[model samples]
Target: MLGPVTTSDPLLTDRTPLPDGLDARLRDHLTFLIEVDKLKTVLRASPLAAADRRENDAEHSWHLALMVMVLAEYADEPIDVGHTIKLVVVHDLVEIYAGDTPIYDTEAGVTQVEREEAAAERLFGLLPADAGVALRALWDEFEARETPEARFAKAMDRLQPLLLNWMAQGGTWRTPGVTADDVRARKAVIGEASKALWDAGRHLIDEGERRGWARQV
Candidate 1:
């Protein structure tokens, strides 16, 4: 009989050989799908010009990871910033499959959960077992919003749209009919996760209204 493999041997690691078909196929499909998302840029106004630049799904994940790096101190509670960042980074992998839906679009937002759930099942399922399970769990945590990590991650997601709209002089709000009050009501949940960011957002929304930048809800 062959001798038992050594526990500390690097070769003993759980990697499986890359096969030629389905075992390797879904990951490629996922990659291509996510790439499409990055190419699907948001349409903005004026100088914002939507950049004609689509931020790929990977870039979106990386951007949120960057936010977690820089804004973690502002979190309402102490957090494992690394873990928090990881959660945010992977939170949108599902967007690759479901496509990015703007929160302000009420009807689009309604189907988000279902779409994302389908996405989660498909995308995470692409990976080999262990990694797939781990990624799915992080994705699930964000969806459930039942943990501190999830709460902060979700807050970051909401905050991103607010920042984009504000930077573009109310890109989302500038739909010629989007009101300021609507922005507040839409973004109020920011407080539930991070009061600090919420307060800042309120100030921005208030000033946005005063400056006639964003319409009031």
Candidate 2:
């Protein structure tokens, strides 16, 4: 049982004093719980998966972090790669509550902003106030796609599945009845951050068409 916490509480450090107290750390823990649970549920939900499975949020975050490392050089604007990585990794923690909504699911439209906004408030608000605010900012930045860092992070998010789809020989594209043109239309957004990667992505999609792995939907 968590009992009353006094100045002598093990969680308290005498060397460091701050106005925020027990409530703050408890909030942080709640945030952690919400995010971790979200990670588990999002794992298998990839749009490119043949099985229509979702990737757990944690795995997806790691994947995006690695992409940030590899594609940082291709960004069109100035960006701190590490910060971009942080933005992508933690961006979807709220989706644990909101759930993964494939962009193509226009009929179901699971990706509504209201649901996500509510999820963000509940999930991110569970953290220490400062941390909650910071994480919420990162999540909002990724959603806004306005800042250089956010643009690059979103670009990576869009490109990764395309690459996976191509490499896996029409993993989700074939099953979802997605076409080369659709892929191009979707990924074109990456150009906002990195022209080089955008061109490369185009070339790859073109090649897939030539190879009969993709066609007009």
Candidate 3:
């Protein structure tokens, strides 16, 4: 049976002369890192704040990590900022293998969940055994959103693209068949973790509709 997952291992750091078996562990961990770098190549539907181009999965994850650091104060209850940051950073790593699914693409259907699970298995399995187990557990926690940290992390994840779409004058919102209601339905979880942030987000949605930047169904 697999042992309990641990976040720390000698494979994570340099050691003089290294321990027996350390080389194989280090190679496994390094291979995971190198493979996950493909996350930078997975383009997302949301554009960057600068509006010059679409943001990739790695950029989206980093931006959400910063939001966790800066916006934890608005969480519905006090939270562990570090844990939330970790959740955000690793939550999207599966996209490196699964590819991104835009929020507005209702036609993409339910198969995405299955695809991401397979991706998570392959991507996280690239790490050393313990590290792979730990990361897979973390990714599942974020997906479940059954804990406060996961909920708050999910709030930031939903909010980032909302802000971006607004910045782009309705970005994917302007895409055919997307509407204000669709955006709200996708973003409603923001209210679960942070009412203050939800209030702010609702105002943006209202403003977008008012400006005709986002269409109403």
Candidate 4:
């Protein structure tokens, strides 16, 4: 049997000095990692498929990453799956700062863009200059939905919660005054990346309505 492997703490131990700029870069990177740990504390409106409680932003991003890996083939246009995964992962890190704005909440939607833009600046600025610019660009690309990868990533982001809600027996679908039409309108972005995914999502919405899990308007 192999014994447990032990590693030294690089920060605690005296070591050969890093090149001038590298030390500060490592510190900034570590700080950003510690800060993003807060994302696990940020609750979302959607519940887990099996668990009773709502899922957190970190869990949501992980799910989106998995969705991209599993469903990238269905994308409307050819996409770089690796790039799409990166997009999904970085996409919601801002929710750590801006907080999640539920799609069905019209009032919150009004300020969503403003809040998230500020969050992107503050959160990504935690990284070293080159990394900050690169990650921030990925976040911006995900938001724009102009590139094929961005469109597919956005599709996964929209689809994950919908699947969870259906699995949770109408999770957010049961929100007061949220009808089937409302869900269709909000989730239609799924079609921009893949008609097939939107078709499946629409089927769920229609079925949820028939089963009284969703309101029909």
Candidate 5:
């Protein structure tokens, strides 16, 4: 039988003194990774496509990342697909700390900006200085939505929940105050990214109305 591995072995301890600043930087990187795992438990209002349970921030981000990859060609303008993927993936990291705020919560939305800004700094600050800077910039870019990558990323962000709500037979839309018009208004920006996706989303909305699952505008 092979000998058991030992933590004290030279092979394990042979790592050279990580250059002066590298130890702290690498620790920061690792700490950030562990901290972000909290996102998996921060649940959103939207349910999984086929599951009754609500999806969490991490799953939502992962779905949007995959959506960006598969739907890149449908973007209205040429975009950096790679950058868009990063934007979608990183966009919700703040929610791990800030907690998921529902879209129609206008009062919460008003405060969400401030709360998430603080959360962004604290969460991204876990990374090495340079890495934290890059991620914070990407998070801000996704928020501003001025660039094509940001726009497309935002589109996927909006579309995913719409598809899920429709598939779940009007998940959040079933809330007493939510109406088909409310859904339309909230999701309007999705058209700016990809007309094709918007069209499909519209069809889903229409079907929901027809089935009396979602309210008519």
Candidate 6:
């Protein structure tokens, strides 16, 4: 079972000393950095593509950033890859405090928005005002999914786990009550950003169903 969610390091709280000359902005930035390091401890439902253990939120965000970089070309509309990377990176930082709400977990999904909104306020507020607002805006943009960059970033967010699940030979698709049709319905957002990726992901889902890795409806 997972332990309690840790937003900050106990060791760092006691050991780290503020430099006398440091400005408030830099100090808050450093503090925020230390807090976010705990994101590495927040595990996701998805397993690593090459490992036996589950992947953590930090690893998931890093992978999504890379996906944005490599897969931006496939986006239905042109996107600023750099901005999209920022969106993906900021998108999940709330999980540091809110904890990961697995996409397929309907029970957990009930309060997901409330939990994440509160977490976003607490986590991003650790930064200096300007930086905090900027990062929070990026998070909001990602959630709204209105901009082209946000849409593409969200696509990467959805696609990453699908790829991992396929590699894991059903990953979350094997969850009880989950079916290939359900996956297609949930992941159809990929087509909103990239038809090519959605096509590929659909093929994986269909094949997984045929192989009995995922349930067929």
- Please write out the lDDT profile of model 4 over residues 50-167, one tens digit for every residue: 7889999999999999999999989989999899999999999988767888888888877788878888888788789999999999999999999999999998988999999999
Off by over 4 Å in 6: 1-20
Best to worst by lDDT, what's the order? 6, 4, 3, 5, 2, 1
TM-score versus the correct structure, for each prediction: 0.75, 0.79, 0.88, 0.89, 0.87, 0.93
lDDT of 5 by residue, 1-217 (tens): 1122222323111243234555776767766776677789889999888666899999999999999889999998999988899999999998876777899777667668777887887778768888999999999999999999999999999999998987788988887777888888899899988899899888888788889887764
Best by TM-score: 6
- The residue pairs that clash in candidate 3, if any, are none
lDDT of 3 at 99: 72
**Cα lDDT listed for each candidate:** 0.68, 0.73, 0.83, 0.86, 0.83, 0.88
List ranges where model 3 is wrong by over 4 Å.
1-22
Model 6 reaches what TM-score against the true structure? 0.93
Instruction: Kindly list the per-residue Cα lDDT of model 3 for residues 80-184, writing each as its tens digit.
Output: 999888899999997766678777775554567877887777778778889999999889999999999999999999999999988988888788987888878
Better of 4 and 5 by TM-score: 4
Runs of candidate 4 with Cα error greater than 4 angstroms are 1-22
Q: Give the Å error, residue 98, model 3.
A: 0.5
Residue lDDT tens for model 1, 1-217: 1122122322111244334565455655454444434323523122322664434556556667888788888888787889989898778766655666665666676777777787677666656678778888998888888877788888887777677667766666776556888888878877877899999988988888898888655
Model 1 earns a TM-score of 0.75
Question: What lDDT score goes with residue 193 in model 2?
Answer: 95
In model 1, pairs of residues that clash are 38-55, 38-56, 179-215, 179-216, 180-215, 180-216, 180-217, 181-216, 181-217, 182-217
- Candidates sorted on TM-score, descending: 6, 4, 3, 5, 2, 1
